[model samples]
Target: MSVLVVGASAAGLTTAEALRRKGFRGALTVLGAEYHPPYDRPPLSKQFLSGDWDEARTRLRPDNLLAALDAEFVLGDPAVSLSDHTVHTAAGRSLTADHVVIATGLQPRRLPGPPLEGVHVLRTLDDAAALRNALAADKRGGVVVVGDGVLGAEIAATVRKLGIAVTLAGPQAALMEAQLGAVVGGLLGELHAAEGVELRLGAAVEQLEGVDGWVSGVRLVGGEVLPADVVVVALGAVPATGWLEGSGLTLENGVVCDEYCRAADGVYAAGDVARWRHEDRLVRLENRTNATEQALCVAANIMGEHQPYRPVPYFWTDQFGTKLQVHGRPSADLTIAEGTIGERFVAHYRDAGRIVGVLGWNAPKQTRTHRMHLISGEGHR
Candidate 1:
């Protein structure tokens, strides 16, 4: 049996490796749109953008590992279509496979503004490199970030580290409303303010103004202008499923899949590109842990073994020298237990006397123990 995996990001690579590890000797091909090798993306905004790490250090699989798997890699080629067990690339090439996995992650959403110079988005290596070059050239410029999500906050933090003045403007009332709750969001605002970054919450940007083909500032919806020398739009990502429009596969916000990551008979979807049913809920997760777990489940199910993908949805972010680790989904009716112990602390979320989520800050061991209890179906003690 031959397998073809599309989009060589975290999901694609993980599925390929899992299939090989599961003793599948069939021909395996990985198609990636990016010219560079598959690299870790979480650090792209932190270490790589800050010039603390090189591209080689951020790579997920080394060159030797690719060779060891003996997998064929078609870098810089994007799968434009999948029909009748054949994958069509934009380069007018077609690869046939018995089973196909769509792992085409997502692309960074762009703001509706003039294509001015110095406007950046952090998603791929090229984006990070370009932003890094711009920052290294003039670290004293006024930087404006147009999103208040985790990526935007991290980018703002990194820009502040380079001795640059940063102003973060977003439509959300606080930072990371989707991840951190209202209280934590306010806390993040305080943290950024303490770090000398300006916060412009509840502000809507109408347009990006530029002078002599360079970004000068951003015009807000209320006719206010915030001056900026470098504009970074850290808006979130949209799934890269545009090519699968007429592919007869179920595509909502992402590719709809079953518990086994199977979309159809011989096709599967994983990672950010997949939205699957988990217990009583349908979720689309964009975390590394979800990608890895879904890939393993998809590989096993493809090899005629049934394995359901039940992930707790883990994600972490490093900012202001603090590590924020989250496990599982925090319930809306959760009771909060927050305390500080020395330099380590935790904020536990409990729903109906059962711990559903835990957010750890500077508490690695405690987070691990919480993760263990949550995974083991244990309630808060």
Candidate 2:
């Protein structure tokens, strides 16, 4: 059997490796639009932007490791179409396969503003490299980040480390509302303030003003103008599934898949590009843990072994020298409370007297223990 994996991101690469580990001796081909190999993205906004790591150093696997898997690597070519059992590439190439995996991941969401020359989004390696170069040259200017999401907060912290002023503006009341609760958000607000970073929550940007085709400042919706020499738009990302339009697969926000990551017969989807059923709801996760687990599920199912993708989704972010790790999904009605254990802590999120999720800050051991309980269905409340 032949397997065609579209995308060379974490999910795609992990799926290919998992398939080989499962003894799939068939023809395996990995197609990637990026000229470079798959690399870790979590560090791009942190160490990479701070000049602490290079592209080659952040790679998920060395070149020889991929070659040892005996998988055909198609770099710099994007899969433009998937019809029947054939995958069509943008470079006018076609590959027929028995099973196809779509792991295209996501693309940064762009804002409608003036042609600001110094504005960028942190998603790809190119984005990180550009911002790193710009910040290294001008370490005394103000950087206005337009989103308070995980990426936005990380970038703000990174810029502040370079002795640059950063103004973080977002529509939400706090950073990562989807992951961190309001109380934690308040704590983070205080944390940023103490770090000499400016926070403008519940603020909307009207437009980006440029001087000589370069960004100068941002005009707020309330008519307040903030001067900024550099602007980074960290307004999250959308699934990169435009190529699968009209492919007869359910596409609601992302490629819809079953519990096994199967979108259709002989076709599977994973990573940020996939939305599957979990806890009686359709969820799409954009995290490393989900990507790796879902890829493994797809790999197992493709190898004639069925494995359900029931993951207690976990993710982490390092910012301002604090490591925030989260496990499981917290409901809006969940009872949330914070507890500290001498610099190591846990935020318990309970739903109807059961612990549904746990957020750990510098508490890896407790996080792992709680994660096991969550997975075993014994930690609710």
- The candidate scoring highest on TM-score is 2
Error of 2 at 107 (Å): 0.9
lDDT of 1 by residue, 1-381 (tens): 999999788888988999999899989999999999888888888999989999898999889998888799999988888786788999999989999999999889988855899899988899999999988876445889999998999999988887789999998888886786666677778888999999999898888999999988988889889898889988789988998988888999999988888888899999998998888867799878788888888989989998888877788888888788888765544333445632356766767767778878778787887677677877432
lDDT of 2 by residue, 1-381 (tens): 999999898999999999999999999999999888889889999989998888888899998998899999999998888887788989999889999999999989888955678888888888899999888766345889989889999899999988898999988887777678776776777778899989988898888988899888888889888888889998889998888886888888899998888999999999999999875889899998889999999999999888878877788988788888888766555333445632567777777766778888777777777676577775651
TM-score of each: 0.95, 0.95
Q: Give the TM-score of candidate 2.
A: 0.95
Q: Which pairs in model 2 have colliding backbones?
A: 353-381, 354-380, 354-381, 355-380, 355-381
Measured over all alpha carbons after superposition, the RMSD of each candidate to the real structure, in angstroms, is 2.1, 1.9
Location of the lowest summed lDDT over 10 successive residues in candidate 2: 333-342
The candidate 1 region of ten consecutive residues with least summed lDDT is 334-343
lDDT of each: 0.85, 0.85
